[model samples]
Target: MDQVKTSIENGVLTVTVPKVEVKKPDVKPIQITGKPTLSTNFEEVTWAKLKSAICAIFLKQPDSCDLEKLYQAVSDLCIYKMAGNLYQRIEMECEAHISTALQSLVGQSPYLVVFLSLVERCWQDLCDQILMIQGISLYLDRTYVKQTANVRSLWDMGLQLFH
Candidate 1:
């Protein structure tokens, strides 16, 4: 039997209720919104900013830019079906970076050991930069590149730049 008892003593009131399990209502409401579209120039502008971030990564100053925003920009472009063009721009940027990096080793052939060390360092730095870029463009790599035939993954593309 369910029972509730109440008592008052010395101007103080006390109440006691039967022990019962109370279930909470499970009413989860999800907010849904229509798809968002970017401006025609959005891709160009976002790519420009991302290019700067890539530059920062190559410069070994990745802390200069907001990585989260860069990741979002890449994801947004991929979502908007701009992955192909975005990949091309990334390829161009990476190619340019590799060319510029190799140019530093041009005159160091006179010192074989120094040249070799410089090459090793350059390779390692490039690897590190590529890893950072892969992190930012993970969505692009996983979605578009994975689904597209003949398209190399970001890491593979970065390494191919050296070849």
Candidate 2:
């Protein structure tokens, strides 16, 4: 057995201990696995459901939308690193709705009051529909949109599309 030696020199304590052979436990390297395999069709199927729900909501038939399922789909897409695809799809849908809304105003009565009222009504409807969509996709906005640069927040994107 090795003994420890201690000494005090110039008001400083010094301690020396003999060394002993130490065996290190074996550590095996872990095989790093990639993310779970998602079927090539998963994204398309999920986006189809989401797109239908979005269109229904825009048509003022939100009661037909399964909000919980939509939310889960959005979360799943984000978790699977498909947030960019989801974002682009939603943006395209909004653009289509906005274009349709603009086209609806093209041949209305020439009276300024009616035109202004229709524009205001379209704006109001757009804001309401956007709020609903934003609620369903809240997780994606908070997680992916917040972390990714140049990605607009949901509400901002809605407003931009309307503009």
What lDDT tens digits, residue by residue, belong to model 2 across residues 107-159? 79799999999999999999998999999999999999999999999899999
> For each candidate, what TM-score against the reference?
0.78, 0.75
Model 1, poorest ten-residue lDDT window?
Answer: 58-67
Q: Which window of 10 residues has the lowest lDDT sum in candidate 2?
A: 57-66
* Residue 59 of model 2, lDDT score: 87
Candidate 1 to truth, TM: 0.78
Per-candidate clash tally: 0, 0
Could you tell me the TM-score of candidate 2? 0.75
Clashing pairs in 1: none
Q: Candidate 2's C-alpha lDDT?
A: 0.91
lDDT of 2 at 6: 98
Tens digits of per-residue lDDT for model 1 on 87-150? Answer: 9999999999988999988997788898899999999999999999999999999999999999
